[model samples]
Target: MPRQACKKGSHACDGVVRRNAEPIAYAHGFDWRPAYNCKQWFAEHSEQMTSDRGGMMKRYARPLRLLAITALSVFLGETLVMLLLPFLEPLPQHVKVLLDASLVTALVLPMLYYFLFRPMALYIGERDRTQKSLSKLSSAVEQTADAVVITGMDGVIEYVNPAFESYTGYTQVEALGQTPRILKSGKHNSQFYEALWKTILAGGVFRGELINKKKNGELFHAEHTITPLKDDSGSITHFVSVWKDITERRRAEEALQTFSQRVMDAQEAERRHIARELHDEMGQALTALSISLQTAEETAESPAAAEQLHQCLGFVERLLQQVRSLSLDLRPSMLDDLGLASALRWYVDSQGQRAGFIPQMELDSLKTRLPPELETAFFRIAQEAVTNVVRHAHARQVRVQLHRREQEMEMVISDDGCGFDAQGLQTRNARETSAGLLGMRERVLLLGGQIAIDSAPGRGTEIRVRVPVE
Candidate 1:
C-alpha cells in the first residue's frame, strides 16, 4: 500500500506549509506522521519558486529540445563513421582517427543547422518581436484618450478601456457580455444602423458621426470608426471601435455661427439708418435748391443769365435722383412701412432695371406682416439669392415665388442660367464665395429654417428657403 505525507499545519501557500507546536485543523487530507523540514527561509519563499518554475520551463522547452536533438545527431554520426573507418583500406591509426572525427564534424554541423537550430532561431525571434509589439499596443489602448471597445463578432461587448468607462458612465463589471445596442441613442434611424452593420459585415470599415447615449441616458455626439477583426480563415471574429466625444466641439461651432449672424444683422440695421438719412435729409435739401434755381431763372432779366439758371436747375434734379437711388440701395423704405412682400416687389422691379431681366413673380397669402426679425431674415435671404442669379446666372429669365402659410413661409427662386456647383460654394472660404451662399444659409438657420440650393454646371440654378412665421 502507498502512503501520502503532509505536515500537521496550515498550507500557507502552494508547495509550502507552516509548522507549529500543536496540530491545526487545516492539515487533514493526508497527514499521519511528523514532517521533517522546518527551515524558516524555505517556508517563507518556496511558493514563489514553484510558481515560477512552470513559466520558465515553458519558455525554454523548445530551445532545450533543439539542443538535445542536435547533440544526439552528432553522437550517432560520429559513432557510425568510426565503425565504418575500421573497414576502410589500411592507414595509420592516428590519421584514420583524425579523419573519422573530421568527417563526423562536417556531416553533423549542416544537419544541425538545417534540421533544428535555424528553424528554431527564426521562429523564436519572430515570436518575441510579435509579443513586444502586442505589449506596446495593449499599453497604448489602455492609456489613450479615445474610447475603445472590443466586441464579439455577434456584437456582444467583451472589453472596454478606461476612456470608454469614463465617458459612458459604465464600469467594467457592468458592461461585459452585454450587447452594444444598450447604448443606442435613438437619434439615428434604423436605416443608419442597417447601413453601418452592412458595411462591417461585408468586411469594410465604417466611419461616421454617431449620437450615442450613456448609462445615465445623456446623449452626446461622437466621431468613430469601427473596423472588423478577422481570423486566419478570413471570417469576421470581432469588431474594434474607437471613438471621441465631439459634443463640446460642435457646440462651439454652433455658437460661432450664431455670433456671425448677429454681426450681419447689426450691419444691415446700420445700413438702413444711413439710407434713411440720405433719403430724408439729402433729398429735401436737393429739392429746395432746385426750386430756388427755378425761381432765379424766372426773375433773370438777361437771356444768358436765364439759360445758366436753367442748366443749374437740371444739375440739381440729377443730384436728387442720384441721392434717392443710393438711399434705396442701402435699404428700401417700403420694407419698413409696408412689409416683406411690398419690399420684395420693389426690389424685383429695381433689379429688373439693372439686370435687364425681370424675374417672373408669384406671391401668395402676403396680406399679414410677419415678426420684424423674421421679415428681415426672409428679405435678406431673398435678396442674396436674386443677386446671385443676376450676377452669376447668365440666363435671360428668372422665376421668383413666395408662399405664406399659417405656420411657415417659403420662397423659391429659379433662374435659367449657367449654374455653379453647390458643393463648390460650400468648400470655398466664407468671404471668398461671390454668391453669399454661406451668409444666406446662416440667415435662414438663425431663424430655425432650412435653405436648399439645387444647381449644376451649364444647367440652371434654383434656391429654396423656408422659415417659421412666428
Candidate 2:
C-alpha cells in the first residue's frame, strides 16, 4: 500500500487511517474506504449537521436553565418538609421519610414535563406525520399508471416505481445502478439528447415525446417529463423522469389521418367526374338548344312568334351560362390544362366582377406544375374562402398571394371585410361554419399542410396556408 507521511491529528489526515491508491479510514479500528467522493462530502455535511444541532441546543438554553430550577425545587421541597416535620412529630419515622420523598417528587414533576416530556411528545407527533406523508407519496408513485424514474446527479438510476418495471420490462434488480441510456431506442439523434441534458442540467424542466426500448426489444412512444430535484442549498441532486406511454394513441392518430386522406381523394375524384359530365353532356345540349331557338326565331312566319322565340333563345343562353359557371365552380378544366395559377386568375377575376370587390392577385409563375390533387385542393379551399367573403364578409377589397418556395407552397388571402368571430366559428361543434371551414381543414390536412385563419369581430380576416411540395 502507498502511504503519505502525515500526523494523525492534522487536517490533511485527521480521519484517514491509511493513504493507499484508495484512501482508507478506520471504523472502531477496522479499515474502510468511503464510496467515491462520499468521504469528503459526508465530512462537510456531518459538520454542518452537528453545527445545526449545536445551534438548536443554544436556542433552547431555557430548558437547561429549567433543569437547575428542577434540582432547586427538590431542595426547596426537602427544606419545607423539614420545617413541617416538627408539626407532624407524632408521625412514624418511616412515614415521615415517605412524606418527604412524595413532596420532592411532586415539586419536580411539572419542571420535568416542561423541560423534557413535552418536547419529546411534540417530536414524536411530528415524526409520525412525516412518516405518513412519505408513505402516501411512495404508494402513489408505486400505484400510478405513468412510469417514474429517479436518477442520481451522475445519471445512474437510483429508483424506479412499479409502473417503470411494467412499462420497460426491466426488473428493479436489472435496472438499478444502470444509466438511462439502457432505454435508448436510437430513434433520436445526438442533438436531441444534448438539448435534453442542457435543459435539465440548467435546472429547467424538460417535457417532450420520446421513443424508448423495453428489455424485450419493443419500442414504445412516451410523453416524458424530466424535473431536477434540489437540496436545501439549491444545488441539483437528482433528476426525476416521468413517462407516460402514448404508442397506441399515436398509432390511432396515424390511422385516422390515413383514412381522412383517402376520403378526401375519393371526394375529389367524385367532384371531377361530376364536373366533366356537366361540362361535356349538359353544356353541349344547352348550346344546341340555344342555336335551335335562334334558328327558329330567324325563320319564323309571324313577327310575334319570332319575338317569342327570341325571348326563349335569350332564356336558354342565360341557362347555358349558369350551367357552365356551375361546372367551373365544381372543378375547372383550366386547372388541369394551364395549372393552378391560370385557374385562380380566372376565378378571382370573375368573382371580383360579380361580387363588386377589387381583387388583388400576386401569383407565382410555377414553371413546373404541382400535383393534380394539390392543385385541386388549394383551388377548392380558395373557392370556399372567397365564397364566404362574398356571402358574409361584404368586403370592398380582397388580396390573394401565392408563392412557390424551395420546399413548400405558401398562400395568403385577406379581405378588408366585416369579420366574424374566427375563433368561435372554428370551435363551435354545431353546423354554424363547420361545413366550409371543416372542408378546408380536411383538404389541407390531406395534403400534409397547415392553415391559419386570423380574424376577430369587426376586424378584417386573413387566411394563410402552407403545404409541402415534396
Candidate 3:
C-alpha cells in the first residue's frame, strides 16, 4: 500500500496507522485505544495472551487423551473376559455373569469421571464464577448515582437503572417500553436529537448538557453522554446513555455570576462618586488656597515672610496636582465628556509617563459614541490589561490596538515582557485565585463577549477581546 499523509483526523492516516501497528487479538472485535499507556499495556499483555492460548489448547487435548485411554482400558477388559471364559466354564452361569458385571463397573467408573464428570464439574464452576461477576456488575449499575439508560439500535428503551427512574420520576414499568423522548422537555429542537443520534450511530460518543423534563413536568439540567455498543461482528447493537444531574450546580453558577456583576456595578458607581468629589470639591478648594498663598507671597513686607509664603504656595500646588491625578485614576471625566478613543489615548500616555515604558497605540476614531455601558466595559478591560502589564510584566514597551466594525469591536493588548503560563491558569481554582483575571472574564461574559489570553513562559503575553455592538 502507498504511504498516506500523516495528518491527524484523516481517514487515510488512521488506516495507515492501524495497518502499521501490531495486531491485537480481540475476542469480540473491539479495537479500543486507551488515552494513556497504550503501547506499554499492549506489550505487556501480548505475552499473556499467547500463554493463555497455549493453556486453552492443552486443556482441550487433555480431555481427548483421557477418552482415548478409557477406550483402551475397555478393550483390554473385554479381551481379558474372553480369555478367562474357558477357565470359568465349570463356574455357575449366574456367578460368571456377576463377576463380569463387577469387572465392567470397576472399569467404567474411572472412565466416566475422566471423560464426562470432570468436564461437567469444570463447566459448572466456570458458570458460577461468570454469574457472580454479572451479579456484581448489576449491583453496581443499580447503586450508581448517575442515571444509566440502555436503548436498542431502534431507539427503544431496553433497560434503565434505578437512578434513571429516580431522576426522571418514572417507574421501571413506565420507562421500559417508552423511548427516551418521554422525558423530553421540548426545550431542544429536533436537530439537536438528530445530531446526537448521528454521532452515536456513527460510533462516536456524544457528550453535552441537556434540559430534560421529569414525570411531573419539571425541567432540570443534566450532563449527558451517549455511547454506542457494538457486537462481536463489529456492528452497533445498542446505545448506552448516562445522565448526571447538574441543575443545582448550574443554578449556583448563575447566582454567583449575577452577584459578581452587581458587585462590579456598585464598585463602579462608588468610584464615579469619589472621582467627582475629588475633582469638583477638593480640586477647587486647593486651587483657591494656592492662589491666596501666591498673592500673600507677592505682597509680603519681609523677605523671610515672602520666602515662607512662596514655599507654602509651592506645597499647595503640588497637593492640587496629586488630587487631580487621584481623581483621574479613579474615573476620568474625559471618558464622559470626550469619547473612548480620546480617553484611551490620554490614559495610555499618562501610564507610559508614570511607568517609564514606551506606549504604542492604534485606536480607531469611532465618530459615533457607543452605549455608555459598553464603553465603560471596554475601557475597564483595557485598563485592567494595561495595569497588569505594568505590574507584572517588566517590559520596555506595550502596544494597544482597537478596531471598530459595523457589527462588532475588538481590542488587543500585548506586552514584550516575561510571560507566565496562560494555559495553566485556565483551571477554576487558578481563576478564582487571580481576581484580576476572573473579573476580566466575568465582565466579558456579562457583555456576551469573548476574551482570549495568549502567553507562554519567556515569551510575551497578548490579551484579545471581542464584543458585538449589535
Q: What local lDDT score does residue 358 receive in model 1, on the 0 to 100 scale?
A: 57
* Per-structure clash totals for the candidates: 0, 0, 0
Estimated TM-score per prediction?
A: 0.64, 0.78, 0.73
Off by over 4 Å in 2: 1-104, 201-204, 232-235, 430-433
Clashing pairs in 1: none
Candidate 1 per-residue C-alpha lDDT over 41-134 given as tens digits, one digit per residue, 9 for 90 to 100: 3652475576578779999997787778778877887888868876875888888778887877887788778867788799899999999999
Measured by lDDT, the strongest candidate is: 2
Candidate 1 vs candidate 2, TM-score winner? 2
> Candidate 1: where is the Cα deviation over 4 Å?
1-112, 181-206, 213-219, 230-234, 284-302, 333-342, 362-375, 388-395, 399-438, 444-470
Give the alpha carbon lDDT tens digit for every residue of 1-470 in model 3: 53222345544433222324432222111112222233434553685687678889988897788778778878877777878889999999999888887777788788788777887899899999999999999999999999999987656788999999888899999988777878788888757776776677679999999898999999999999889998654667788999899999999988887887789889989999999999999999999999899889989999999999999998999999999999998899899899888888899889989898899999998878988778888888889888988898887889999999778899999989999899888855853457888778888988888999999988889999999997
